[model samples]
Target chain A: MPKPLLALGCEGSANKLGLGVVSHDPTTNKTTILSNVRHTFNSPPGTGFLPKDTAKHHRTFFTRIAHEALSTAGISPSDLSCICYTRGPGMGAPLSSVAIAARTLSLLWDKPLVGVNHCVGHIEMGRVITGADNPVVLYVSGGNTQVIAYAEQRYRIFGETLDIAVGNCIDRFARTLGIPNDPFPGYNVEQLAKKGGSVLLDLPYAVKGMDCSFSGILAAADLLAAQMREQDRILSAEGGKLKEGEVRITPEDLCFTLQETVYAMLVEITERAMAHVGSKQVLVVGGVGCNERLQEMMGSMAKDRGGSVYSTDERFCIDNGIMIALAGLLAYETGFRTPLEDSTCTQRFRTDEVHIKWRDD
Target chain B: MTASTGSQDFPCVLTLDVPFPTARLASIALQSLQVDKELSALVRRTFSISSSIEGARGDSDKILKVEYKATTNRMLRVAFNSFMESLNLVVEVMEELDADVLSTPIAA
Candidate 1:
């Protein structure tokens, strides 16, 4: 039997720095998650994470996380077959921060380096974890929003956001509400949205064929939040009672409406992609994929079409190092190694730029 | 940046020499650090490898030299500060994951 291969993956695409080790058997097509560790940088409540600060967070914690991941997996540098790092499609500084560490490790252990695309990493990890075969992928994250399907060795984008991403929209709204960024703004928004739905506030729904827009929705939502705050202030001054002609509004209602409108837009485009590609399985990946409401909405939509939606928990759905490791290992198996000179990062690497050589279909 | 002579525009300048234990390590550091181009047009930077030894063999090329020239002292400070962050990370990784990290003492 051919020996099993092990890979170490480093991911520092944005605010999160993740390191993981994975094992793959050549003969059985089996993959084992050895150890996956992550460290996230959360800025203040009203501020988004800056590039330099996020990069510093990754730099400060990378060595410690790497040691923990390797020891947790009970392995050393010599046991690894290759070093894999996220190459592009993320913030440049954090990506470069991770890439430097990956390069250093490669040279130290005399191991080959594999540069994995971030979107492809999410999709490949989703497939492995959910065992979904040829599913239409909905990749929703702070930096990206796309509906992708496999064709001709590429994860072709059928639909995408024209402006800000859905996650960005929600995160900004969370900031407008002064929600803390302890875990993530999206998660906090979802929790708030669950308490809402007593009143469905009106918000713009922008879905154009295979593409959608979120900036308009975000603007409308922000305006509604402002109105809600104004109403709250008026009610407080008026002994907790609004004027006879005025209607009460709450922040929770705005959150609920935002979730419903944006998720409906995503489902509409995803349904179109499924029809266009003639695929039944739907795989939701990326950080926003962890939202229970989004999953429930997607689940119902898929069920109506005699299909099912596949998603993983936070550990696999969020930006992680294991996905990069898995995707890079697949590429490494296919004889793909990024040369040291060519290992550069970009902030705008699109999903279609990579050719998927691992999957035959 | 504070060292600016105020002689002309872009007067503030700084040069940094980062030494590694081995020539190969120094080259690795240079290759890894030089990939990311400086983001600011106000800052001009260059990277080169040098050593004190003349025509040094295996381990003679042991210094990574980085020079910075910016329009102002503030620009120089910001640019070199970021560079130092990256440089610190590289050295840290070398200490943690380098092959020699686990060298065991030999007993007679």
Candidate 2:
């Protein structure tokens, strides 16, 4: 029997910094996750995390997180076969910060470095966790939104966002409502949306063939929120809650409406992709994939097509190092190692650029 | 400790060794501070993290070493001041909100 290969992964392409350990046994083609630790840099309400600030956050926590992941996995640096890290398709500063740490670890341990694409990491991890052989993937996150499928050594992007990503739209709306960012603005928005009672405000629903746009919807929602704020101030000064039929719009209503509209658009595109590829299974991954509403909508769509929808919980859905480790380990086993000089991170890395050597058919 | 007097080729040089509790903290500082784009054509900066050999003996202390070179003393001072502001914020964030201080349960 061939020996098991262990990999250490580092990921900080956005506000969250993560470290994880994964092992793969070639004899059985089984993968095991030993440890996955993450620390997020949540900005205050009404603000977004800047590249520089997020980079600083990754730098401050990378070492400690790496240490914790190693200890949790019960392995020392020498026990790993290679170090893996997210190489790009994210904010430049945060990506470089994590890359520098990975380079340092590679030098210290004399281990080869494996640079993995951020999107492919999410896809591979989803497949491993959900045990889905081949599914049309719906990837939604703060930085990206896309529907992908595998074909001839590439995960082809069938549909994607034309403007700001879905999670970004939710986060910006949460900011407009002054929601707390501790757990994540999107999760908070989801909680608030539960309080709303099907009061769908008229927001733009944009789906252009296989792609969607959120910027227009975001603008309209922001205007509605502003109008609500102005009315609230006037009503409060008059010493009364919203009177009957005064176009009452609460933050909860806005959140509910936004979630409904956006998830519908996502489902529309994902369904289109599945039908085009003639696939029976659909997989959802990325940070925003944790939303139950999206999963539910996709589930209904797949059910109508006599298919099934697969998704993992927040642990695997959201950005984490384990995904990077899994993807990089696959690449490493196929005889791939990034030379130190060529190990630089980039702000834009396309998913289809990667040659999917680990899979056939 | 000491500023390197400039030669004809490179005029002024300033070096700083900022200490942190651990090598990780120091490396974080180095990585964050190293991303700043050089504002002036006349100035250049380099940053690195160095752990004390005493760390191997159990102390575990590290330092972020930064060096700046400029065509003139005024330019060097200006760039150095801006760098210090960024460095201060980075260090403050590390001290107050790092994973060690904000050890909340992972919401898996």
Candidate 3:
């Protein structure tokens, strides 16, 4: 049998512009990622964040990166059967930039352009890397967190956060703790939680059916932290503060509590989704997926189910182009292409809106 | 082809002329129809007016001319109800209303 076609995927959602090239070999029934390129945007301090500015930045950076990715894979654009890009459910400005770039490339190279859902791309990539064919997908990122399962020409959401995502909760909590907003601050907080000797402060846990409310938890965490700090300041002024080192909840301990509480909520919801779907496997994907504690909890859940918990290494698991490309190729083969007139931008595209096709073999 | 029905269901474009204060009036009318049993599920599609309005000047008789694509009578009725509801809800700026302000629906 002939080998499957090779496709390139482009992603520029949030701050990262990622590119990946992959081949689907039908003879072996496997997909191989050739190479990937990633670039990030750092808004200058005090410069207001604008979606359109990011889009403008993408137009300048994309062509060179595409070439770099192709060359890194030791392949040419001419060898690509199709080019895929994230279509919607992202900042309209950035989505349009990548869309326009993809269309231009497709037109020039005479290749088909497949628009892939960013969320589905993340989930499918997680599935591909972990080799989890039908695991429950808990997708969490800067913008989204939805418990999803693939069925009926769509990846249906079993449950999701009704408000802000779990990661944003952790990130915003870190900021309230005066901790820097970094990719791994949340992870740092996780480690601190490990070291923290439990105070077990009372905090709200909001879970509704399979769906959850992270915003309440986040608000509570922030308020608690703020209130504790205020009390500490008052004690200091009264000369009644801890004798040099005596403290109830240190910064590290606060970080620990935040991570523990957020992760517990996520774990609870994930387990609910798993039990509801009756699926043995669980696939965790997103920036928060990198958290070791989250992984451990999911691993135990998988063990209980007599199944395996699958996750990718930091690179593939994090938002990137490789997942987009891998998922994009499947969509392309399924004849999922958009017309020029119908092309538009969107910010809240749900995962179940698109039909996904990719086999884990 | 054999003649089968008393009246044929012809697909035609009907231009609905809505007399309202502003486009916001039309938008409000549409929003109200979403939960109204008579018109809730009848709205097949909706589009915003793009051209700037300068022709109509009467406060009591502002016109919102909508071109609707409908086939069956039921759908046309829904469109009419939706348009009327939208017309009723339109205001100078959305903040003036007591309704919960929502983030605009993400266009796809």
> Which number leads on TM-score?
1
Query: What is the per-residue lDDT of model 3 for residues B4-95, given as tens digits with 9 covering 90 to 100?
Result: 12224435345545444455544443332232223234334334443234554444424444555455656766666545433332322232
Instruction: Tell me which of candidates 1 and 2 scores higher on lDDT.
Output: 1
Give one digit per residue, the lDDT tens place, for model 1 in A88-177: 899998999899888888877889999999999999999999999899999999989999999989999999999999999998989899
lDDT of 1 at A59: 94
Over 4 Å off, model 2: A239-245, B1-108
Local distance difference test scores for all models: 0.89, 0.87, 0.68
lDDT of 2 by residue, B24-100 (tens): 77766665456446758999888876665334554554877788899988999988876775676566555443444
Evaluated on the second chain alone, the candidates' TM-scores are 0.79, 0.81, 0.35
lDDT of 3 by residue, A1-361 (tens): 5767898888987667888898887557588888988876655432323675766667667766776677688776667888788876778667766765565456445577777788988987887778887888888766678888877668899888889888778766666676543444556577677887467766787888888888888788777777778768877785666556444666667766677676677778888878888988888898788888888877887797788788876788777888878887777766777554444456778888885554432
Which candidate has the top score in lDDT?
1
The candidates, ranked best first by lDDT, are 1, 2, 3
DockQ-based CAPRI category assigned to the predicted complex of candidate 2: incorrect
Quote model 2's TM-score. 0.83
The better candidate by DockQ, 2 or 3, is: 2
Write candidate 2's Cα lDDT for A1-361 as tens digits: 5789999999999999999999998778899999999999999998999998998888778767876887799777777899999999899878877876676667556689999999999999999999999999999999999999999989999989999999999999999899998889899999998899557899999999999999999999999999899888877785766667777888889999999999999999999898899998999999999998888899999999999999999998999999999999999999999987677788899999999999989
Interface RMSD of each: 1.5, 7.8, 19.6
Q: List the residue pairs that clash in candidate 2.
A: B6-B11
TM-score for each prediction? 0.94, 0.83, 0.71
Ten-residue stretch with the least lDDT total in model 3 chain A: A40-49
For TM-score, candidate 1 versus 2, the one ahead is 1
